[model samples]
Target: MPEGHTIHRLAQDYAEAFAGTEVRVTSPQGKFSDAADLLTGGRLTRTDAHGKHLFLGFGPAGHPTPAESIPARPAAPGRAAPGPATAPAPAAQDHDDPDHDDTAPSGWVHIHLGLFGKVAFGPVPAPPPADTVRLRLVNDTAHVDLRGPTTCALITAPEKRAVHDRLGPDPLREDADPGAAHRRISRSRTTVAALLMDQKVIAGVGNVYRAEVLFRHGIDPYRPGRDITPAEWDALWSDLVDLMREGVRANRIDTVRPEHTPEAMGRPPRVDDHGGEVYVYRRAHLPCLLCGTPVRTAGLAARNLFWCPTCQQR
Candidate 1:
């Protein structure tokens, strides 16, 4: 599935294309038709993302908050195909976020793109939507399509808050509290790798970030969370912020430091579909970028974990 940065990038894309405007909401697939009907003429007043969850706020037509009006940035054209095959729709109970007002007048459309979900954008004269579209938003300037999302529901303000209340802190959000995540991590016997992948423990980290961040810090993936010192946790958290933020800006995960980039090292750019240079993460059996040790991989938390065994000594 797409990482937290991809979700945040989608939030920015949705805001730039349709937020604050009167949107034509529809569910061509008929699954979300009722909610779309209710939101059809409403203005997209706000857009938010926490971890992999996305929210598009709808309310009566009025002035939108300045915050929702982000300046457009150069992004990849058309579709964002970020994950693997389709899976079951997500349960709202899994991911956590901070609560919005429980008494607000507007409603939120929560979306979680499980593996195989995709999002696409286009100009105003959008072509006929495919029968698979779960949601579509149109305005004078652009149109966007959502397909195969794990969770797409029209939720009341309180319901949105409830979802957020259950989630751990999101590093991308200004409101995130690293200490909250540290508290949970410092007390757990679980491997730090598993803890980082747990949404309930730390929002928005996926296999890619979890593996790459650990490799970057030379941390053993098998290290228990309780064994992670506060200073190490702090450094890890701060690196996540920086790397994920760069991911948002570039719309891709490139975790390699400047000196390790292809240009700096006189090496060809990485040729993976994920489109990022990194020390580890899907580079199994390849030489480690730093120590020239063969990168290793194993199953952890149901996802592949990659690291440099020589560098990430326990």
Candidate 2:
């Protein structure tokens, strides 16, 4: 399954390409004919994502707020000085904002690309694969195809609320609260591996990040979440935010540092970088990047879990 980073990136791309545009929505696959009608001729106001769920908000004549609407500003002063008679400082505003509520369609559509789903953008003149196309949204300049998505529907405000209510904190959201995720995970007696995979515990974390985070923190996946110290949990969340941010920017999960690349310099290939750019993921039975111990793998939560026995001892 595509991780949170991938979903976040997709949301960003969709927002840029289709948001604020009146799109001709269609169900080429015919499975979503009813949902397509609710979205056809609707304007895409914004694209929002939480964990693995992607919400594409469509509004009527009024444009929906873009994700960038909530610009991050410094906290306001606790109390404005009692006397503001003097020239009041110009009202603070986010100058960096480039978003606008432009003329567009008024409708809403939401899609969740479960595991194998993907989207592609092309000019309207170009043709798309008719067979695999699940949904298509087009404007004058561009068209987006939703292929293989697990869920694609026209969602009302109440429906969106219900979906968000079921999810835990999403690390990719700007307003995400790691403390909430930490507290939730801390209460679970489930194995850290299984707990990490639970969307309700922390949205957007998949098997890859799960194994990598545990290995990075030297925490055993077999350990119960309740056994993890609060400080450790905090560190895990912090590290995940950092790692996930990198993944979003790079569009790939890279646990190994570039300097660690085997052909990076004059040095001969390092054993770990024989194939290059990973610590243990898919490098099972290979030598560890930190210690030279052979990387090991085992089945955890029905997925292959990789780690260095020496580096991540129980």
What C-alpha lDDT values do all the predictions have?
0.82, 0.69
Which runs in model 1 stand beyond 4 Å of their true positions? 67-105
Clashes of each: 2, 7
> What is candidate 2's lDDT per residue for 1-314, written digit by digit as tens?
78887777676666667766777878788888887787777677656677888767666534554444321212223534222211111111111122432422233466789877888888877485587788888888888888999988776655666776788777766556778877877788988888888888788888778878888888877888888888988888887887776676566776656666665633454343222256677778877767889988898767888878888765
Write the residue-wise lDDT of candidate 1 on 1-314 in tens digits: 99998988887788778766888999999999999999898888667778989887777667354441332343333644232201111222222222543223367899999997899999979999999999999999999999999999998767888778788888887678999999999999999999999999889999999999998898999999999999999999999988887788788899998899999999989999999888899999999988899999999878899999999985
lDDT of 1: 0.82
Instruction: Write down the worst ten-residue block by lDDT for model 2.
Output: 87-96
